[model samples]
Target: MLQTLHRVTILGPRLSFGSRPFSVSSILRANRAVVYTQTGDPSQVLTTVTYDALPSPAPDTLNIRFLLAPINPADINVVQGVYPAKPSLTSLVEGHEVFVGGNEGLAEVVQVGTGVSGLTSGDWVVMTKAQAGTWASSRNVRPQDVLRLPRADGLTEVHGATMTVNPPTAYNMLNDFVTLEKDEWVMQNGANSAVGQAVIQIAASRGLKTLNLVRQRPDLDDLTRKLKALGATKVLTYDDLADRALTKTIVKDWTAGKGIRLGLNCVSGKDTTAMARLLGDDAYLVSYGAMSKEPLSLPTSLFIFKNLTTAGFWQSRWYKTHTREDKENLMRTLVDLVSQGKLKEPEHEILSIGAEESDEAAGQKIRDIITKMSAGQYGKKVLLRFEGAQ
Candidate 1:
């Protein structure tokens, strides 16, 4: 006869099931999470905590197991207490109350509670709310807090995990601010970024042209080739913009003398001012981020003579002001774009935490990655995957 088996928690005592088969519920009790007790430098304050399995979902809730979560720059800011939005502190662990560190992720429904409709076990979903504490093995969330994907072919975990922030930011910035006819041109800096790549593909889908600008790098030629392959009309580095007259002539020729009407700026300071100079009259200049940590300074003449209008956008604000139905519609639109190949997943590397690794080791790995990210060492996005013990 086969011997009875037992399961052990990640940080707690063993749970023995003598002569009885282990149930799915019993097997899913171990969880590991990245959390912090205080806001400071992420590398210094962030640590990993393993706790016993989460309690079963309460009414109108579902238990979710995260498949992957991206460490967005905003998430780092949130951890450092620099970002405006903050996550709530929770005493999920036995001895301490801490804040979890993830803004977006893709998860699978492990179980559903009574009164929960439309979502069942094995369904894939992403949080509708910001700071849902997604950097973990498992947790319980309300049905209203998540949006379910159609499980269509080609909708990978990365797409869902990242869809909420970058893709939507690009889509909205393009649609909300200005109206561009087919073949019309849009200019944006930081075009090699995740949102920038999304802007390229989304603009291509709509027959709009994008003049993409990125910082000069060793692989400038290769990077230019990749962006062009993704439907960017042109890719040039900041160095190319140094000669103002030459750059304007080139852009003028590229746009067939129509000139660009929309400029997207994520990297502020002198480069953005140069990019703004290429815009035509009545153009809209939208600022979504300031990666350079420099103030945006545009010529007063641009506003008076060119009718340049400057504005800022935050996805979190959009979510707060919009209805649930509106959010679902936006997500569905993006998902369809992904399914149809109009949009490509951002370039990324997965940082996986093995089940056998200790909590200290996992935390150290995450801190190291954060340090690299802070130092601008990681060019591609970094995603986290925490493997649970079997």
Candidate 2:
């Protein structure tokens, strides 16, 4: 019974593909979507529009209509021709055609293959394929590429849509690194970020302490208080981190019985080097971002004395090559956490995509929204929505 929030929702029984007896007008028609026709200059090329009919039902297909999608940092990078993975370039819609624009969405099955019984048309599911078109009305997809989402029970579509990228990124980083003993310390920067917040909660929930490092903001006290509320052991600023004795403080704060086991680096400039020096011997360091846009320079002593292990994580590529069982488990746990009010993304605004925006207007719309998020002022998630679907 997942329901749309603050909008008129149309919910019905799953439709049959073959020998379907439903009347034409009674069925939901023409989904609105945002898409692009060319690469480079996304604002000038991509557009949003609506189609009057659904794709022909296939026996091995799961036809899904999206409820909500997110404009992630990576989505902007891909649109700006910077990401390594590219989305598909085909669109089956009639006049004023458009290709889908987002990498993730929360969708409901409107129709399933006769060969597919594990997931029915009315069930909510996530795309199992790495590049499934999610920024659209309804898409016909192969059955295996669809992950029959476990019982959402109490999770909202907002949580379902965004809970994937950041939470999983945080969880995998915490899991794949060196194992930690109770009361042991783990150091990381970007303490205010969504992923960083998740890291704090998950690590806290697992009996590990976090030495969180954040840049000084106008409201630094509030940020520090928030992180501490999320179970941060100590919050330090970049200026505080510049002190050579800070490493000694971390060592002293941890139970010497159980030393620091790992360091997670996301803000890779001076912050990374500072975090590196703070690690003890046999420490594992993992990075998943380049927010500082600087090379991760480290001193040779880190390798010689500390014996640190450093690695990088790219969620899309990692999940693409890994098992779905892990994904399902992580997603299920994440939803449970979100439902229990222990995890969340900052909700910014919901976008109602227009039905008649020109291609240029549509592209500009996405570009404007992406640029706004990149500015780093808004502490909320930007959600893209269909005007009709909601």
Candidate 3:
């Protein structure tokens, strides 16, 4: 379960700065952001910076105030200097340069440039791609860098904050890979993951079935019940999949004479081999993540006899190749599922940074959350909320 945070918007005084004294606009909005100058461990490198005033939007930009931002595992990876995509360093911080440390988040258009079109004040939007520096109070960005989202579509701020990554990844993998028909099956490990949960619900919405696999746990029964309710056709522990007879029996019954044609693997090692063995002839296995930190070991028999085609999926690369319109359509579809109650938001915890709090307080809070996340101590996804302004 997730507790909701109450939002507090602090407005600044209106002023006129340009040639025309008649021009009235809000000036000198205070800002706070979590930034890192050099890539290293998050707790060591991340710093909280403050701005007494944010500049108004430029002719081709929009002033976006972040409503919420998620602390994803990939975010920690990028900060630790492991991820491929790197944020640009800036000297705007006065004495030294810094790089903002967030990728996915939801924001509101506080101000739009005179030349901007299709977006206005109060409209909600999200970054179209990664490395947009979302962990802040506000930013001035180009209209094309973000995609507008429908507030009336019925998604909460938490859901919107996370919209750019996990759900979209699951949605694309399901559609981009093997064409699965109604009642057809798709198998995946990390069944309890955010992406896995989204895959289960989306598959159900399309009348597809899923065989979900997870590691054994004390509350396995409860976890199984929960995932089943989320539309998983089968929720099995890794031990269950490891049992040869049990694996054959489950796959035989679920496939109904047609073996699983699509396999999504996040955990590699033996888990990858087990899934590869279950794929039918001409099946496709897509590896999006390596949660196990072990190299994938494929048996020679799978490719020679099963004719399985192995590939990889990365949402960032997909965004780079796809167009803006394509991204919008995907977001609208995913949000509609939430609006219609076909898909459920995952469990999450919110970390609020109040205006009265010092920069060290904010940085310490983020550090604690990231430390727990890295240690796998939290079950709920963690999101950050800034106070003082809408």
RMSD of each: 5.1, 7.9, 7.6
The best candidate in terms of lDDT:
1
The segments of candidate 2 whose C-alpha lies over 4 angstroms from its true place after superposition are 1-30, 95-99, 254-258, 354-364
Q: What is the lDDT of residue 312 in candidate 1?
A: 96
Give candidate 1's whole-model lDDT.
0.86
Candidate 1 C-alpha lDDT tens digits along 72-158: 988999998999989988776665567888999999999899999988899999887889898888888989889887677688999
All models: lDDT?
0.86, 0.70, 0.83
Worst 10-residue lDDT window, candidate 2: 7-16
Better of 1 and 3 by lDDT: 1
Q: Report the CA-based lDDT of candidate 2 relative to the real structure.
A: 0.70
TM-score of each: 0.91, 0.85, 0.91
Which consecutive 10 residues in model 1 have the weakest lDDT in total? 9-18
TM-score attained by model 3: 0.91
Candidate 1 deviation (Cα RMSD): 5.1
Residue pairs with clashing backbones, model 2: 109-121
Candidate 2 per-residue lDDT, tens place, 288-378, comes to 8879999998998888887877899878876787787877887788777766666655545787565444333544676677667767655
lDDT of 3 by residue, 1-390 (tens): 322221222122111111212111211133777877677778777767665455788898989999999988999999999998888875434445568878999999999988999999999999985788888888888999999997655688988998889999999999997898999999999999999999999999999999999999999999999999999998877887668787888789878878788999999998888777888888999999999999999988888988989999999998999998899899889889989888777788889887766566677888888998999998888888888753
Q: Judged by TM-score relative to the true structure, which candidate is superior, 2 or 3? A: 3
In the predicted model 1, the residue pairs found to clash are: 29-53
lDDT of 3 at 153: 58
